[model samples]
Each structure stands twice: as structure tokens, then as C-alpha cells.
Target: MQVEMQDIHKAFGKNQVLTGVHFELLPGEIHALMGENGAGKSTLMNILTGLHQADRGTILINGKERSFSSPKEAEQNGMAFIHQELNVWPGMTVLENLFLGRELKNGFGFLKMKEMKALAKEQFERLDVDIPLEQEAGLCSVGQQQMIEIAKALMVNAEVIIMDEPTAALTDREIAKLFEVIDTLRKQGVSIVYISHRMEEIFTICDRITVMRDGQTVDTTKIADTTFDEVVKKMVGRELKDRFPARAASLGEVALEVRNFTRKGAFENISFSVRAGEIVGVSGLMGAGRTEIMRAIFGLDRMDSGELYRNGKKIKVHSPGEAVKHGIGLITEDRKDEGLILDFSIRHNIALPNVEGLSSKGFIDGKEEQQFVEDLIKRLTIKTESAETSAGNLSGGNQQKVVLAKWIGTNPDVLILDEPTRGVDVGAKREIYALMNELTDRGVAIVMVSSELPEVLGMSDRVIVIHEGKLSGELSREEATQEKIMTLATGGE
Candidate 1:
């Protein structure tokens, strides 16, 4: 099967998101879509998957023109899209999520639970996914949830599979398993559209690549014919000198210390210290308690026992407000759900954390708020028309930036970033790395939680690994290789 989009054009009111975008995917081949933050990749995928209709263009499935009225229609036509965000119901079981709307039933009109469970188990075994069939989806790890999503697509017998940042939260071992599954799908003649920001994964799996810039198609070429630098340049239209900035040598006194941090069923005995000018990375599997530790530190979750010290002085943090007042900031993992006020404009979102700073005598200073937001947008290189633009309308990467800008406005001494670059593009990722370095250089301590090992190794001055709600190991940047991190993260240490 071959899927092609010809001259696709889509717009929302006066804003054009996709302009004359063209792409093609051949059977047994992985086609990658590369672009900057707001380059219309998601819009185009939405159009293809029938979530949005193209204003003008033609979609040909197996060289036959077709129009889909809804995502169900697209799915019926052998197309499936695995969104960047998982859509499975947390309360449902794996079998239930796999056959959600299309459940198999007997003539008695009852759900065939046994059959569904057996089928789901077989599918997982075939895909080498170790998700439990009867377990609640919410109890599963992020990587396991993703595998369930893929299994659901396979259950539908989709010929054209569109994966949007499928590996964003997956560990190296899980990613390798996913690649193996993709290979098997390709061998069975499935046409795949792989969207991702990680260049290494693209080069490893994709056969051809299409670069989109500002809603327009820049170029399409074979993966073997282009270099990573070339693809990145085409995506952002600029040369990025370095992905991670140089770390400063001078270190101030310990800014934050957590001793005997214990959270029942989450993490225990976690002891770590962050210096004023250091960036420490916590790397682990999806359920390895990395995010849980950060959440506890920021007072988002209750801790059974922990002693926290700031500059050698013990302090108690009981809430997010207290954490913020104590010069602590947290960038949550789920930006859409926890980080942003989507109804507000960029200026409003950026001013949210530091609203008091922008207010005077019970009235907000609009001019001061605008100036601060403008400066932040400039500093972060957020590609937006103006500060008045709605935060919801911004791209995923820009939205993440807005979250960062909002936190930075609070002027925190310690910043905690959880999956900071989860859905950002290559260019935006470079900017974020540079910003992290700049913040650390200015005497701010950073504690980063990420599933990406390369990012942890590249950006952190020191790395800590957590496994099954316990601190497993710690290493300096030089000692934190992919193998060592994996070993420690999986409790091999």
C-alpha cells in the first residue's frame, strides 16, 4: 500500500497551519516527518487522520482518492494514528483498551472477555511487550502504555500507521523493542509514518525523510542521502552551534539537599544534593520513581519521611505555593494538564506564576506584564506572532517554552524539570539545553528527570538512577554511559 498527500492546505480562521504540504509513504518503508515546533506536522497528521479536513488537497490511499469525515472513517479505511499523548482509559484493562470501541461479542450480546484477553496476550507476546492483560491501564508504565497503543492499532489491522513521537517517554530498552516491532510491521508490508525529534532514531528506522518548515514542505530525501546536521538545518533553517552548552566550573554552596526522602510505594531513601551551579539528572525507567521524587520535592505529593535543607537550614515544603515562595520551581511532565492555562494568552500564562510581581496595589500592571513576557519570548526564541497570542494555539514546543518562561518568571533558586523536552523539536531542544546551561551558570541549581539516556548523559553534570521506588546508583557525567544507566535503572546495580 502507498499513501500520498497532494498539495494539502489547512487553516484555522486567519492562521494558516499547513500550506501545500505534500508527502508519500510506501509499503514496508518508514517515512519520517521532520520539522520545527510550529511547522504544521501535527496539523497535517490531523488532516490525514480525519480529525481535521484539509481546505484543499487530495489524499490517495493505494492511488485511489478518498475523503474521510471522521477518525472512525479513517480507521475503517485501514488508517490509524497513535497520538503523542496516550488515549487509553486509565480505568480499563489492556484487553478492554485494545478492543475499546470494537469489542468482540458472542451471539448472547455479552463481551467475550476470555477471548479478548487471550487475543491481547497473544498480541503482546508477538510484539514482545510485557504488559499484563488484566492489570488496569493506569497502573502500567508509560512505555507499557505506549505498547498497548501500538497493540490497539494492530488489533484494528491498520495498514497505514502514523506514530507521533511514540518513543518520547520510552527507555532505551523499550525503544529497542519498539523498533523491533516496527521492523516486523514493515516486513508485513505496513506503511508507516514516523514523526519524531530524535535524529538518531530517525536515521536508525526511517527509510526516507520529509522536512517541513513553517507549514511548507522544505525537502524530501532518502535517509541515507542526508546527514543529521543537514536535516536539522532544513527543519529550523539555521545552524545550531551546540546542542548542550558548556558547563561552568565554579560551584556555590549546596542549594538543595534531600536526606532519607521516603514516600510509601513511590520512592524511599533518596538522598541527593544540588550545588548552586550544577545540573543533576535523574534517569530511570517509566515507573522508576524519578518523577515521583521531583513531585515530592516540589510538594505536589505527600512524603512519608524526608529532611530537606536549603543552604544547610532545614525547611518544610507542604504545598506548591510554599515551594514557589521558597524560590523553588517545577516544570511538570504533563504540560497540557498541569503546566498551562490554555484559555489565556502567552503574556497571561507567563505572568501567572509571578502575578504579584506584575501587580501594583490590587491592580495588574499591563505594561510591565507585556514587557516581561516579551523579554521572555525573545530570550527563549519562542516563534510567536506576539505575546497576545493564545497559549493554546502555540505549537507543542512553544507551549513547553511558555511553561518554562512561566516558571523562570518566578526567579527560582532551584528549578526542577520533568521531561523538559518530551515533545519539542530538534531546534527547540537545542534552545532549551542552552537555556539550562545559562540558568546553571547564573548560580541556579537544576534537577532534571528524563527517560532519555543520551540527553541525561549530554546535559547533566551528575546522573542519578532510580529503580522500583529506590535510589539505585549515582555517577558523574563522564561515568554515565547508556549501558551503565540502563543497568542501574533496571536494578542491575
Candidate 2:
């Protein structure tokens, strides 16, 4: 399938999302769409896949102008879109989700369960997936859920598949497996539009690249014809010198310490300490209890046994409120669900944690609240029309920034960040790193949990590896490397 979008123009209300944007997809080539969070990469793809109709444009499929009414119609015509957020029904079985809405039924209106199971198994086998068909979709790990999405796309016999940040939740090993599957699909003449912020992955897998900026196509070039620096310059309209800023903060005494942290069936006997003005990065593969330990520390989940020390004094945290009272804040990984209430305004989300300070006689000071929100928005460089804009209306990077601002308002002595830059773009990531440096400069201890090795290495003063449910090894910044971290994360000596 060959797809060509010529002079696509789309707008929602007065906000123009795409203005004369253009994109192309070849039959069997893996073309990458590169852009910042709001650069219109997703909007262009959404138009192509029939989720949104273009106000003015021309869509040519195999050189014939065509338009699809809905995403289902697009899928039926050999196009599939695997969204970043998986679309699996938590209550349904794996097999059920695989055949959802397109189930094979008998003449009497009975489900063909056996046939569905066989077909799903065939797709799973092709992707080297080992999940049980009868298991609930919610029980699977994030990596497994990603595989399920891939299998579902293949089941539709899609000639063109659009994958949006497909490997965000996957482990290193799982990513390697996915790449292998992509290689096989390309050999079978399936075209893929791969969208991701990871530069290494794009350079490694993509044959051609198209860069979009400010809702317009900036440059389209072959992978071999471009460099990483050139791509970054095009995406941001300026040269981004260093991927990470320099850290020059001095270390202080231990700010937060966890001893004998134990959560049965989750993680066991995890011990770590982060000092003021220091960053301790926790590195591990998916489902390796990295998130579990952070949740326990933040009082989101119960730990069967553990002792927490703050400022050299033991303390008890039974809930998130208690953690905040003790000057500890947590920025959850799932920002959409745990971090922000999407329906609320950006001012509301930022002021939620600091209500007491902004209130007088149990009534919020509107002037103070507005000024506070505006200052943080400007400080963080969040692009928005107004502070009253809904947080849901912001892009992925700006949403993450709002979450960070919310935590920073708490004036925490110790901060725990889990995958802070998971869905963010390169430009926003650099800004976040600079903010981390500034926080540490103010003597705030930080613990960063991440799966991206480059990020862990770039920002962390020290790195700790977790495997299964226990601490494996720890390394100083001077000694840590990707190879050593992976070795320890996999329980090697």
C-alpha cells in the first residue's frame, strides 16, 4: 500500500493543528515520522487513518484519491493503527480482545470460540508471544500487552500499520524481539509508520525519515543522508547542543533512607538512600519491581516490612498525604491516570497540592493562585494559551511539565520521579534534565526510576540495578555503563 497526503489542512475550532502538511508512505518501507510532541505528527497520521476528516487535503491510496469515514473502515481496507495507549479490555480474555467487534459467528449467532482461539494462537506464534488466550488482559505485564496490540494489528491482515511509541513500556529484550518482528514484516512487504522519540531506535530501524515542525512538513530525507544533530536541529528549529545539561551541585547528608523495604510477592528487602543535592537512579527491566519499590516508598502501596528515615530521624508514612507532610513528593509514571485530573484546568492541577498555602479561611485566593500558576508555567516553559486551559488539552511533554510543577510546588526535601521523560520529546527532555539539576542545586534529594539507560546515565550521580524483586548492584557515576547496568539488572555477577 502506498499512501500520500498532499497539502493536508485541518483545524479544530480556531486551533489549526495541521496547515498544509504533507507525508508519504511507501509500500514496504519503514518510514519514521519525527517531531516534537505538538508538531502534528499524530494529527497527520490520525487524518490518514480516518479518525479525523481533513478540512482540505488530498489523500491518495495507490495513486487513487480516497477517504475513510472511520478508523474501522480504514482497518477493513488494510490499514491499522496501534495507539501508544493500548486498547485492551481489562475484563476480557486475551482471545476475546483479539477478536473483539470482528468476531466470527455461526449462522445461529453463536460465537466461534475455537476458531477464534486458533486464529489468535497463529498470530501470537508469529510474534513469538507466549500469553495464554484464556487469561485476563489486565493480568498481563505492560510488555505483554504491547505484544497483544501488535498481534491484533497483524490479525487484521493490515498492509500498512502505524505504531505510536510502541516500545515505551517494553523492556530491552522485548524491544529486541519487536525489532525482529518488524524486520520480518518488512520482508513480507508490509509498510510501517514508526513514531518514537528515541533517536537510536529511529536511526537503527528506519529507512527514510520525515521531520515535522509547527504543523508543517520541514524536511524529508533518507536515514543515510541525515545525522542525529541535523534531525534535532530540524525538529526544534535550532541547534540543541547537549542532550543533558551539566550537573554542578554539591552533595549533602542523606535526605531519605529506606532500610529493609519488603513487599511480599512484589519486592523484598530493598534498601537505598539518597542524599540531599544528589540523584540516585534506579535502573531495571520491565516488571522488575522498580515501580513497586517506588510506590511503597511513597505510601501508595503497603510494604510488609520497612523503615524510613528522614533527615536522620525515623518516620512513618501511611499515605501520600503523610509523605507530603514529611516534605516528600512523588511524580508517578502514569501521568494521565495517577498524576493529573485531565478534566481540570492547568492552574487547578498545579494548585491541587498547594491548596493550603493558596487558601485563606478555607477559600482560595484567586489572585495568588493565578499568579502562582502563571509563574510556574513560564518557569517551566509550558506552551499554552492560558492557565485556564485544561491539562488534557496539552501535549505529552507539556503534560509532564505540569505534573512536575505540581510536585515542585510542594517544596519537597526529597523527590521521587518514575519515568519522568517516558513519552516526552527530545527538546522537553533537555529542559526537564535542567530542572532536575536546578532542584538538586537547591539541596533536594532525587530518586529517578527509568528504563532508558542513556537517561539514567546522563542524570544520575549513582545508579542502582533491580532484578526480579531485590537489589542487584550499585555503581557510582564514574563507573556505571550500559553494559554493567544490564548485567546487574539481569542478576549477573
Candidate 3:
């Protein structure tokens, strides 16, 4: 199997996202695509997977020129794409989702359930993923859901597989398992197109690397022949000074405190404290209530019993409006669903929480709103044509910046970020981390909930682990480690 894309050019209206991009992949090789945010990586992949048509290009599969009218056409031609966003149906079970639109039928034309379950189970085993075929897909963790998506592609025996940021939300162990599976597939003559921002993973797993910058292919090289610094230079066209900024503030008195926080099945007795200018991180497995804890604190969900204190003063919050009024802002994990209104313009989204700040006598002051949004966009360094651009049209990294800008407009004293950098490219991830440090230096406390161990260990001033709806353990920044956190998270302590 071989895929050769020649001089691919794509444009949306006046935005020339992809320009003469050329790449090739061979059988039994894992090829990694590297680029910064809005570097035309997604556009090129979309063209290859048949999600969008290129304005001018040639796609040759196995030495034959071909046209893919739809995703089904590409799939029929042994091509599969697992998008960065999971597209599984929550209402359907694992087995049903695996065989949807192509179910096996008996001679009587009835649906064949037994055969589907058996096949689904076999596929799960082949990937070494533990999931119940009869269980609803929604009930599973995000990592398990991702595994199911990969298994679906494998069930069709795709010769070419494109995985976009597959390990963004996976733990170290889960990532190891996924890499093992990819290696196995490669040995079976599968050609994989891997897209990720994790430099180490690309060097470890990919056989060949292609660098794309500003919608053009910069260079292609073998993993063994390149270094991380070289790849970063090619991706950004410059040297990156420090991924994480220096923390300059000394910790102050406790700024936010939670006592006996309980939400029944979600999380319980989650007592923690964040001092002024301190960054506290909550690390746990998916479904272990990391995000739920953040939501509960931000008043998105009702708590059965809890006490919240801000600056040594007890406060009661029952709604997000109250949370904002009390100087609490939450950046949700699902940015597309809960953070931003896709249909709204960037100015409208940024000024949502702080609309009152831009109003005079019950009427919105357009000039004031525009000035505030412009300042925020500049402060956050959000890449956008203008503030009037729709939030949905921005890339994943830019959309995340909009979410941050929206919350920061509220001038919250404590900010809670749930999976803050998930699905973002490496350059964007570095920018976000630097922003967090800057916020902390300005005396704003931050609480981060992340599934990535390295992120939690690297950024947090203190670490807390939750297991089975309870606070498993808490460790200071100096004491927290991968092994220690994993042990506490898995209930070993």
C-alpha cells in the first residue's frame, strides 16, 4: 500500500490553507505529520480523507490516481481516519457502533446480533482494549471510546489509517498500549499517517516524518536522522526559548478552599486548597471525576454537600452566574460544547460573561465591547482575521484561546481549567502554559484538571489524586511523581 499526494492545493473563500502540499506514505510504515497550530495540517488531512475536496491536487493510491467523493468512498478503498474529535454515537452500544451502516443480516434479512458481538469482541482483543461490547458507548471512558473508534477502522481492515492526535487524552500506560497496537498493525503491512504535537512520540513511533509550515511541506526525514530541536525549528521556523515560563511569585495565604465537597457518584470529600499565586493540579483517570470536581466547584452541577471559602470568607454558589459574580471562572474540558457558542462571533463570545462591564443604562456599548475584545485578543495573542470572525471557524488552538479570553474578561480571582491543552499542538500548549504562569504571577489562583501525567507533574504547585469518587491522596509539587500519583490514583495507598 502506498499513498502519494502531489501538489495539493485547497482554499476556503480567500483563505489559502493548503498550498502545494506533497507527501507520500509506504506500506508497513508509520509516517508522522508535524506542524504548528493553523499550519494547514488539518486541511491537508481532510483532503486526503475525503472530508474536503482539494482545489488542485492529485491523489495516487497504490500507483493509481483516484477520486474520493465521500468518506465512505475512501473507506471502501481501504482508507480510514480517526479524527481528533470522537464521533461515536452515545445512544448506541459498542457492538452496534462498530457495525453500524454495515450490519450482518441473516437469510431472513434480520439483524445478526450474535455475530456482531463476537466480531466486536475479537477486535477488542486484537487491540488489547478492555471494553464491554454490550455496554453503551457513552458509559465508557474517553480513552476507551477512542479505542473503540480505532477498532472500528480495523474491523474494516483498512490498508491506510490516519490518526489525528490519538494520544491527547491517554495516560502513559494507555499510550504505551496504543503504540504497541500501531506497531502490530505496521508489521501487518498497514500504512499509518500519525498526527500529533508530542515530539517524543513522533521520534519513538514514526518511521518517517513530514513537516508542514504555512500550508506547505517543508521537509521529510527519517526518525533516526532527525532531532527534536530540528523538528521544532522546522515546524515553527524559529527557536523556542522555554516551553514553560519562569514562576516569579511567592505563595501567599490560602485563596480558595473546599471542605467536605461531595457529589455522590461523581466525587466525594474532595477537600483541597489553593494559595494565592499557586497552581494546583488534579490528576486522575477518565471517569475518575476530575472534570466533575471542577464543574462542581464552578457551580455547573449541584453539590450534595460542600463548603467553599474564598479568601477565608465562606461563599455559597448555586449557578454559573453566581460563580462568576464571586470571581470564579471555569474553562470546561469540552470547549466546543460548553465553552464557546460556535455560531457567535469572537467579540460576542469574549464579551459574554462581561457584557455588563460594557453596558450603559441597560444598553450595550458597542465601542466599549470592541475595545475590550481587541485588547483581549492582543493579550492572548489569538490568531484571527478580526474579532467579528465566528468562533466555530477558528482552529482548535485559536478556539481554545477564545475560551480563555472569554473567561479572563470576567477578571476572575480563581480560574479552573479542565484539560486546558487537550488536542492543541505543541506550540499552542507552550503558550498556554506560559499564560498560566503569567496569571499566577498576577495573584490569580489556578486549578487544573488533566489526564496527562507529565502535564500535571510539570505545571502544578501541588497535586491531588482522586479514585472512586474520593480524594485518594495529595502531594506537594516536590513530592508528586508519576509512580506516586499513579499508585494513589489506582487506590494502592
Which is the leading candidate under lDDT?
Answer: 2
Angstrom error of the Cα, residue 387, model 2: value is 2.1
Per-prediction tally of clashes:
0, 0, 0
- Clashes by residue pair, model 2: none
lDDT of candidates 1 onward, in order = 0.90, 0.92, 0.89
Model 2: how far residue 58 lies from native, Å: 0.9
Query: Pairs clashing in candidate 1?
Result: none
Q: Which is better, 1 or 3, measured by lDDT?
A: 1
lDDT of 1 at 355: 88
Rank order (by lDDT, best first) = 2, 1, 3
Descending-TM-score candidate ranking: 2, 3, 1
- Which 10 consecutive positions of candidate 1 have the poorest summed lDDT? 241-250
Which is the better candidate, 2 or 3, if ranked by lDDT? 2
Alpha-carbon runs more than 4 Å astray in model 3: none
> Candidate 1 on 1-493: residue-level lDDT in tens?
7888999999888788888999988988999998998999989988888899999999997899987889999999899999887887989987788998999899999999888888888888877888777789988867788889988988888898999999987867778888998998999999899999999999999999999999999999999999988998899899877776676646799999999999988898999999998999998888888888998999999999989998889999999999998899999988876899888999889998888988999899988988999999999998888898899888889999999999988989999999999999988898899899889889999999987777898899999899999989999977889999889988897
Worst ten-residue run, lDDT, model 2?
82-91
Task: Write model 3 residue lDDT over 1-493, tens digit each, in one string.
Answer: 8999999999888888899999999999999998987888888878887889999989998899976888898999899999877878989998888998889999999998888888888888887788888899988777788888888998899999999989876766778888998999999999999999888899899999999998999999999999988898899898787766666657888889999999888888889999889999998777788887888888998899999999999999999999998899999987876899999999999999998888999999988999999999999888887899899888888899999999988988999999899878778888899889888988899999988788888899999999888899999888999999999989888
User: So what's the TM-score on candidate 2?
Assistant: 0.97
**lDDT accuracy of residue 416 in candidate 1:** 98
Tens-place lDDT per residue, model 2, 1-493, is 9999999999877778899988899999999998998888888888998999999999999999999999999999999999876788889999988999899999999999889989998888877788999999988877788889989998998999999999888888878888998988899999999999999999999999999988999999999999999999999999999998988769999999999999999899999999999999999999999998988899999999999999999999989999999999999987877899999999999999999999999999999999999999998999887898899888878899999999998889999999999878899899999999999999999999998999999999999999999999999999999999999999996
